[model samples]
Target: MTIGFSSRTSRVARVAVCCSAVCTLAALAVATNPEGAGLPFGTGAQDAKAGQEPPSLYRPGTQARPRAGAPRVPRDVSAVSWLVADAGTGEVLAAHNAHRKLPPASTLKALFALTVLPGLPAGLRHTVERAELAGVGAGSSLVGVKENRTYRVADLWRGVFLSSGNDAVRVLAALNGGWRATAEQMQDKARSLGARDTRVVSPDGYDAPGQVSSAYDLAVFGRAGLRNAEFAAYCSTATAKFPAGGWSYDIQNTNRLLTGAGVDRYPGLIGIKNGYTSKAGNTLIAAAKRGGRTLVVTVMRPRTGGGLAVYEEARSLLDWGFRAAGRVDAVGSLVPPRPAAAPQTGPESPPVLEEKEEVTGPGWPAAGVITGAAGLGAAAVALALRLKSGRLVRD
Candidate 1:
C-alpha cells in the first residue's frame, strides 16, 4: 500500500481545504513578515517562502504521526536526501530530504557536465586522457577507454552519462585544470547557482567524508545541466560509441529510467543520472517533459529491492505532478500565526531588514526552499532537512 503522488490527487479539493487550514503551522518559519502575506516584489526571500510550501500542495500521507498500517513513502537509498524540478523554469516539482547532504556516488558527473559545457571553447573535442588509466584514485568504473585514445568532448560527454565514466570525468576535470581545482570550480558554480547545501570533495561523486549534495542541490544541478544543450543531448542517450585504440566500444546509460528493461515507464521521461553503493543503496536523478512542462525527480537511499522501486516512485510522481500542476494554483494566502519572536535581534541588528528580501532574488537557501516546497504536497517535511548543516536528525 505504498502511498503515491497520483494516489493523493484523488483528494486535491480536500487538500486545498486542508492547506488553508494548515498553512499556519509554517508561519513561524518566515522571517520579519508578520502577516505572512503574499510575496513582495523583487524580494527573493519572499518568493522562496511563497514557494517553500504551497497552501494547495498535497503529497500523500506525510503527516507528523502515521496512522496504523499506512504505506510508507520509501526512505532514501543512502542516509542523504533527494529533489526534483522543472528544467525550463527552474521550478521545484518534488523532493525527498533534499537538503540532507550525503555522498553522491557517480551522480556528480552531472555537475562535471555543467562546469565543462559552459567554460570550454565551443565545439571542443575530447581526447583520451593519459591520466584516466593511471589510478584516478579508487571506485573507478571501467568503460574500457583505452589510454591515449581520442574522442570528441561530445563523445566523452555521452560516456560520462551512459557509463558513469570516472575516467572520462577525470579527463574532463583535468582538462579544466586538475581534479582539485576542478572540484573547487564546481563548488563555486554551485554557490553561484544558490545550491547552499552542496559541497564537492571529488571530481567523481565518490564516497569521500565531505563529498555531498542534497536532492535539492541535485535538482539545481539538473536544471543547470539541461541548459547545456549538448549535455542534455548526451544524457538522453541510452547508448554511445566511443573510439578506443581505433575500435569502437558501446557504453550504456546507468539510469534505469531511460534504458532499464522491464521497469514501469514514465511518459516524456528524459535524461539525468543514477548512483549506488552498499552504503548509498540506490540513488537516482531523473527528468521528463509533458505538455510544455518539465519535472525533475531525485531518489536517494531508497528501499533496497529489485531496483525498480525508483522507477515506480518516479512514474507515480510524474503522473501526479503533471496533473497537479495543471489543476492547482501556485499562489495562495498565508494564514498569520502567532510569531515565535523572530530569532532574537541584537543591538547591532539593522532595522527593517536593512534590505527587503526579493522574490527569486539571490542569497536565499535555494536548496532548502526548493526541497521544502516539493515536500509540501506529500506532508514529508523531513525532505527539507539539511543533513550537512546538522538540521535533520538521523534515523
Candidate 2:
C-alpha cells in the first residue's frame, strides 16, 4: 500500500541512526553494573536457539538500524544502556543495549504508579497509618507522610511523583493492600505491558537484591503512563503542596528537564520521572513533545559523568529523535505483542503487532508510525513541511 507522511511527522519516520558505541559485554560490564549485569546479549548458541529474538539492532554490542542520510545516534550518550522511541506508536527509533537489566532506583516508580493509578480514584481520601511507613528502606527518598494525618489520594500521588518518595509509595501500597502485594501486582502489570526486562522487587523502586529493570522496560512504563489522564497530570506536575502537621511545604519534581531544577529547561518537556542510588547511579525517563510528535527516552547508569549526564543525555536524545523523525525506520518496536496462545516465560515469546482499526485522516503516519501534535508550538514543523514535499511511506 502507498502512504504519504506529513513533512512534519514524516521527519519522525525511521529517524534512527547508527550508534557511536556498539556497547560490547566487556565494555559494558563496568563496576557500576554488578554481577555481570552488563553482559551483552545474543552472544551464545542459546540466543540462536531461542525463538524469541529481540530486534537485531537492540541486542548487545549492536547499533540501531542505519539509514543512508540519517544522523548518527549521539555519541555523547553516556548511559550504559539507553533507548529513544516514539511514545504514541511505540516505535523504537534507536537503542543500545536496550534490554540490559540493571537497578532502576526510583524510576521504577513509573511502573508502580502505572500499576495502581487506574484502579484508585484521585479524590479518594485516606488517613496515614504508622505501620504503613514502617518498611521504607533506609536512605530512600521521602515525601513526608505524617501519621494520623488525612490526605487526599492526589496529594499522596504528588508525593510519589514530585519527591520520588518511598514514604508516599508505602502509604499508597498500603492502600493497595501491602507493599509486598503491590510488588506482585507491579510484576503482573509489567508482563501485561510487554516489559519483559523488569523485575519488581519494591513498589517504591528502592535498591534491592533482585530488583532490576531495563531501558526498554522503563521506556514502556513512561509511554504507557503518558496515555492515562491521571498519570499524565501527576508526572507533569512540577510542584505541589503536601501536609506537614497543620501546615504544608512545597516540593518540586526531581525531573530536571521538567522544572529545570538543576539543569537548563528543556523545551516542550513533559515530565516522567527520575531516579538514583549509590548502586543505580542515575536512571531517568523523560518525554518531550514537539511539532505534533512526542518522544520518550530512557537512560540507565551513566559511566563517566555523574547524575548530570543522565539529564543531558536524555536531552541530547530528544533532540536527535525530533530531528531524525521521518528520516529512518524503526529498528525494533516498543509495542507489546497481541494476546497469543503460548508460554509467557519461555524463549518463544516473539513480538505480535497490535491490530489497528483503519486510517481515515488526510496526513496519517504509516502503519507502524504514530504521530500527534501536542500543546507545544509547531512553527518549526510547519516550516519544515512547507519546505519539503511529504515523504512517501510504503507499507
Q: Which number leads on lDDT?
A: 2
TM-score of each: 0.63, 0.74
lDDT of 1 by residue, 241-286 (tens): 7667667877788777788667744567787888765555566778
lDDT for 346 in candidate 2 is: 50
Q: After superposition, how far is residue 141 of candidate 1 from its true place, in Å?
A: 2.2
Residue-by-residue lDDT tens digits, candidate 2, 1-395: 76566555566432311111222222233322332222356354444322244456346853576578988889988789999999988888888888888999999999999988877788999988889889889898998888999988999999999999999999899889888899999999998888888999888888889899999899999999999989999999998888887799999998989998778989999889999999889999999999999999999998987669899999999999998878877877778776756535557764443456232222122331122222112334444444445354437
**Candidate 2 off by > 4 Å:** 1-54, 341-395
Model 1 lDDT-worst window of ten: 56-65
**284, model 1: CA deviation in Å?**
1.2
Residue 86 accuracy (lDDT) in model 2: 96
